[model samples]
Every structure is written in structure tokens, then in C-alpha cells.
Target: MTALGLVHPGHGAEDDYPRIEQLLGSDIRVDLVHTDLGEEPRRAEALRAAGLAERLTAGVEELRLAGAEAVVWASAGGSFSHGWEGAQQQVRDLARAAGMPASSTSFGFVHAVREVGARRVAVGTAYPPRVAELFADFLRAGGVEVVAVRDGGDPPADGVAGWGEERVLALARDADRPEAEAVLLPDTALHTVSCLPELEKELGKPVLTAAQVTVWEALRLVDRRVHAPRLGTLFTREPVVQV
Candidate 1:
């Protein structure tokens, strides 16, 4: 079985691998290494000190040791905090260390948005407003337009992880706009896969979530572009949308 390495960029969501596995089905196995990023304060400080790159690199080698064929930094803000180019270099560094393809949830969001053919999108994030703004900027750099954004205001550590499905659904609903082609929820810490059908059904458009798209990005890196109709529009090879 092909193995996918998942690196928790320190938000303490250990259950991420199982969640990805569930969405990915039994064909692909996931090996995870969590780098223990501590509370939001410590996580933010690491971003400020530019410590996340080092941490992600460290975890990549760990996943390599576990025989993971590729790696994904599951936290979007971890890479996006460094801005667009910073996010690009972050994955490059990870791939260099792991000696395999690499990506971050941040980059995953960008690719996922493009996969859905969304030129304009609405973003809802659980990070502080500033961090949310950076993610939106990362998308713009990827050549997508962000029509609306909702910042959930930074909460304590595990704040996003603690959110129920209803909360995540609400955020997606709130982030949607008539002009937006898609709704983006950019936190891997949140549990999103179970309710993807309901979320998309309600919005009547694509709803891209972090964990879901991170898996999608991993598949792309490994050249496994199987369309997951159950996952959502992004996983399918269908045209994203016409500009």
C-alpha cells in the first residue's frame, strides 16, 4: 500500500491521520508525526521566529523513518504565516529533508481552490484575524480572488480542534457569498470530512476544507488523481469552474 506522511505542524490534532484515511479509503495508508507546537501563543511565536520550517523538516524525517512516501504539513497557517513565497519555500524544505514530494495545508488550500475552478472565494478561518488575512493573501498569490473573509478570532490552543461539526458547518455557511464560487474553511484542526456532503449540499457549491484538501494535494503529489465523488468537486477531474 502507498503510504502518505502527515506532519502535525504543532496544533495537537493527533486524530488527523485517521480522518484523512477515512476520506482516502483503505487503498492509501497514512503515517503521522506530530511536532507538538504547544498552545496558540507558542505556535504564533514559532511563526514569528520562523521556527515552523525547522519543525516541519524535523517531522518529515520522522515520517520518512516511518516509510511515508510523501508528506503534508497539516496546518494551513503554519506555512501561510510566512506569506506566499515563504509558503512555497517551506514545502521545498520539507521535500528536501524527506527526499519525497511535500506540501502544506496552506498550499493545499490554494491548489484545492484552483481545482474547484474558483476564481473568487469566501474564506472562514479560526486563526486570529491577522493570520486569516495572510491565508487569504496566499490564495491571491496563487492567482485566485478572495471575495469575502470571516476571521474567527484566535482562540486558546485546540480551540479549532474542539469545534463540533455544527460549528464548522456554520462557519462555512457564514463564509459563503453570492459572488463567491466556493467557500473555504482553512483549519485542519477542525473535524470536516464527516459533514462534507451536508455542507456542499447546503451551499449548492464547492466547500473545500483543510483536511479534505490536504489529502487531495497529497494524492496529486503521488500522481493518484482518482476522482473521489464522495469527497467533493475538488477531488474529481471535472472542470473547476469557468471564470
Candidate 2:
């Protein structure tokens, strides 16, 4: 059984760990650590000042004590808020500090898209429209095209986690477009891990949600892939044909 360590930037969102466990089974242990991000609004400046590298290092040390093989920063907005280069550097710093493979959800979205072989994608988020646009910019900086993007804007401070599955999937459906090979919902706040199949069915494409890809990327960092049908196309076993 492989143990994975996750460092979340704020309180709450512990629901994600169990969701990952349900798909991958109880054998794969997930060690969770939360970092206090204060009560400040989750804007770019505030998020950059959150000092996740230091906090994440502590979490990594804790997970190492628990026998974790890899660690992941499970915040989508927090990492992307650092922009492309900064996000890369943040991950590098985390790996260096943790002495193990580390990743952030922002980069997880990119890696998931690349794994699915998509160059163009639609983004659906539970963030301010401007923040969602930042994600578009982030993807563009990574060489992936954003065909459509939409968001509810800043959701009254405490509103994102309370969003129901129907609401999240609606936002995803709205962002779905003809040119997009995948629809990306980039928020660790919303409870998305349970509705991946519903979202993928609604969008008629590979649907990548924040928590889903974060766990996937962490597994990928260690060269592991779990093929589960309920986890959507990304986790389905790739069929091999005779050459």
C-alpha cells in the first residue's frame, strides 16, 4: 500500500481524502495536513504571502513519519495564484524540502490534460470570474488553449465549499464547448470528487476536477496509475491494440 501526503492551505476540505480513498480503496493511505491561510481573501497577493513552502515542509515531515511516499499541495487557486514560473518553483522547493516528489493542483491540471493528450480545454471554476481568467492565463502560459471559461466570481467568502453537485456540474456544462477536448473545474473547495462521473457525462468529455487530479498527479509523480471506471476517463484502463 502506498501512502500519499497532502497539504491543504486552509481549514476544512478534509472530505477530499475520503473521496480519494473510496475510489482507490482503503489500502492506499492518505495522510492529510492543513495549513492555516488566515481569514484574508484568497486573492493573488494574499495567497502568495501564505508561505506554503515552509508549512508544506512541516506537513511533509509529518507524512514521512507516517510512511508517506509522496506529497502534494492540494490547493488549486493557491498554486496557480503564484503564476506559472512561481508555481513551478514552489513545487521544486516543496520537493527539495520534503526530500520526495511533490506537486500542486495547479500543475496537476496541466499534467492531467497532457496525459489525456488535450491541447485545448474549457475551464469551469468556483472562483471569481477574474480568478478563473487567471487560470486561463496559467494554462495558456503552459501552452494549453482555453476554449471557454466561466465562474461564479468570488462566492460570498464562504460559499464555494457549500456548492452542491448540481451547481458545480452546471458551471462545468456551461464551459463545455465544441473545440475543447476536456472540461477543467479548478477548485479544491467544491466537493467534486464524488460527481466526476456525472460531470463527465454532462460535459461529454474528460472532466478534470481539482481534487481528482491532485490525487492523480501525486500518484503519477511516483509512477502509479489507478484505473477505476467511476473515476472517469482519466482512470479507465488504456486499451492496447496490436501494432
Candidate 3:
């Protein structure tokens, strides 16, 4: 059985993994290592920026020790805090440290966009406009067009993490642009897996969110392919799919 390692941000999203595992079917084992980035609402941004690489590497090492075949940084904004090149280097460094391939949720978004054959894309976020703009720039650097964006202000990062499914789904549906081929909701903190089928059906286009794509990318790295029909285009795409 293939083992995939996940380095998650905090305590809340642990319940989401079993569903991801079930969606992936029986060929893989997921080993998760939790790292608390602290809960100080006032220091969220500064903490996210400063602690990303350190947290990522620490989690990677732990997973490696636990016999994980691959490591995935399960936080979207975390690796992305360092910007585009920094994001790439972060993964490279993690991979080197872990003696295995490494990836992040931000990289997963990049991969998912290409997996679904999307070029022009629109993004929506529960982050501030400034934080969301960082994602926009990252996508631009990866050669994808960011047609439009909607930020739900800088809701306290913890509050944003605790956002309910209905509000999260509504924000995604409303932020989708008709002109764009795909919609990207780039927040790992938000719960998105349960709403993907509904979102894709309504949008009539691929909907790529952080958690879903991160799992997809992690599975691919370990040579596992999951055909979870309800999870939309990202999960349904073959492992050989480009990007």
C-alpha cells in the first residue's frame, strides 16, 4: 500500500481526512501529522509568513520518520506566504529534507487548473484582498490567467478556519465568473470537499478548491489515482493528465 503524508495546519480539519481517504478508495494509506500554528488571531498573518517553511519541514521530517512515502503541506496560504519562487523552493527544500517528493495545497491548485485544462481562471477567497492578491500573482506566475477575484475581507484567520460549509459554498458560487473556464477557491482552512459536486454541477465548469486538489496532488505523487466522481474534474482526471 502507498503511504501519503499530510502536514495539516491545526486541529479542526482532522475529520475531513477520512472522507478523502474513502474517496481515494483502498489502495493508499494516509498518515497525517498535525502542527499547531498557534491561535493568536492578531498574529495570524505574521505567524503564517514566518513559520511556514519551518513548520513544513518539521512536519515533513515527522512524516518521514513515520514511514510516509510522500509529504504534502496541507495548508494553502502557508507555503504561498513566501510568494511564487519561494513556494517552489519551499517544496524543493521539503522534498530534500524528507528524502521524498513534496507538494503543497498551493501547488495543488496550480496542478488542478492544468489537470482540468483551464487557462483562464477566476479566484475567490475568504482572505483579505491583499492575501488573495498573493494567490492571483502566484497563478499568474504559473501561466494561468486570473480573470476576477472576491475576498471576504480579512476575517480573523481562525474565524475563517471555522467558517461553516453553507457560507463557504455560497461564497464560492457567488465568486465564480461566467467568462472563466474554472473557479479556484484557495483556502485549506475552509471546508470544501462536501460542496464540490454541487459546485461543479451548478457552475458547469471545473471547481478546484484547496483541500480537494491537495489530496489529488498528493495521491498522484505516490502513483495513486482516485476516480471520485462526485469530487469533480480534479479527482476524475487520470494520473497521467498533464500539469
Candidate 4:
């Protein structure tokens, strides 16, 4: 079995891992461990805290014991809020702590974009304008062009975890453009595993969602790939062996 560990921030949408593990078939195991977010709002200071090396490492031993071959910091908001270089250091610290290959959702989006052969992408995020821009800048630092960035507005009355298919599709539609080679949805807090097929169909292009890319990124760290056609284009492609 290929076990991938995810260090998530606080609560919301962690269940996407199990759903993806099932979709990836019987051989893949997704072990998730959440770090405390305390009373912090979903802004820069709080997000920076969320990706702190110490907080992320607290769950490393648990995941390592669970047979995790690789670990990923699974919160895009937290990682991107650290900026590109800081996020890189965060994962470096995590790798040392977990004693394995490590990455995060911010790098997941960047690497997933390249895996799909897309150089230009449009971002569709549940974060407000400011937070969404951080993601765009993060993408830029990875050499991917941000053709556009669309905010999904305030969280729903029930929050991002409660965002259904229609709301998710709308965000993709609002963000997609003719110039974009792919559309990126970068909030792991939003549940997107179920609607990946629909999002790609509606956009008629590749759609990379946070939950999906987080798993893909973790697997990529260990040079693993699973055939999950229902998950969308990233999964359907052959694995790119890392050098």
C-alpha cells in the first residue's frame, strides 16, 4: 500500500482525504492529522501560525507510525500566506521532522499545473480578494502565470465545507478565461473531490482543486501515481518521475 500523510490546519474538509483514498482504490492510504488553529481568523497571522514548523511537526510521528511514505502540509491558505520562500522552508522543516519527502498545497497547485502542461492558470478561491491574491503571487513565484484570480466571495452561510456542487462550479466559471490553460481552486477547506468531473466538464478545461492536488502532491513526493479517472485530468495522466 502507498500511504500518504497530510498535515491539515484546524477543521473543515479533512474528510476529502478518505473519499480520495477510496477513489484511488485499495492500495492507497491517506492518513490525515490536524493541527490546532485556535481562535485565529483565516487571515495572514493566523495562517502563518497554521503552517508553523512546530505545529505541522506535532503530527509527524503519528503519521509516520501509520506507514506514511510522504507528508504534505495540506492547507493552501496557510502555506501561501507564508509566501513562496517561507512555504518552501516550512516544507523543508516538515520533511526533516517527518523524516520523509514533504510538500504543501501551495506547491501542490504549482506542480500540478506543470504536470498538466499548463503555464497559465486562473484561480478560483473561497478566500476574499486579499487572500486570493496571495495564492496568485504564490503561483507566480513557481513560474506559473496567473491569467486571472476570482474570489468566491464570503463563505456560505454554512461555511466553505458546506459549499455544494453548484457553488463550486460557479467559482470555476467566474474564474476561467479563454487565455487560461487551466483553472485552479486552491482552498483545501472547500470540499471538491466529488465535483471534479463536473468542474472540468463545465470549464471544458483542466480544473485543479485544492483537495485533489494536495493528495496528488503528496503522492508525487514519493513518485507515486494512481489512476482515478473520476478525479479529473491530473489523475488520468501518467506519472512524471521526479529527478
Among all windows of ten consecutive residues in candidate 2, which has the lowest summed lDDT? 234-243
lDDT measured at residue 136 in model 1 versus the true structure, 0 to 100: 85
Question: Candidate 1: misplaced stretches above 4 Å?
Answer: 41-51, 154-158, 239-243
Clashing pairs in 2: 128-153, 128-154
Query: Which structure among the candidates has the greatest TM-score?
Result: 4
Better of 1 and 4 by TM-score: 4
lDDT of 2 by residue, 97-130 (tens): 8889988988889888887777899987767777
lDDT of 3 by residue, 44-147 (tens): 37536534666667767678877888888887777676677888888898888789989888888887888888888988887677778877888888888999
How much is the lDDT of residue 32 in candidate 1?
75
Better of 2 and 4 by lDDT: 4
- For candidate 3, give the lDDT: 0.77
- In model 2, the Cα lDDT at residue 100 comes to 90
Candidate 4 residue-wise lDDT at 162: 80
Error of 3 at 237 (Å): 2.7
Q: Write the per-residue lDDT of candidate 4 for residues 1-243, one digit (tens) a residue.
A: 899999988888888889998899998899889898755445667777877778899999999999999999988988999998899899899999999999999999999998888888999887877788888999999999999998856544566888888988988999999999999988787888999999999999999998999999998888887889999999998654544
70-149: candidate 1 lDDT, tens digit per residue = 88877776777788877788788888888999988888888877887778999977767777787788889988899999
Q: Total clashing residue pairs per candidate?
A: 3, 2, 0, 0
Please report the TM-score between candidate 1 and the true structure.
0.90
Best by lDDT: 4
Query: Per-candidate RMSD vs. true structure?
Result: 2.4, 2.6, 2.4, 1.9
> What's model 2's lDDT at 81?
81
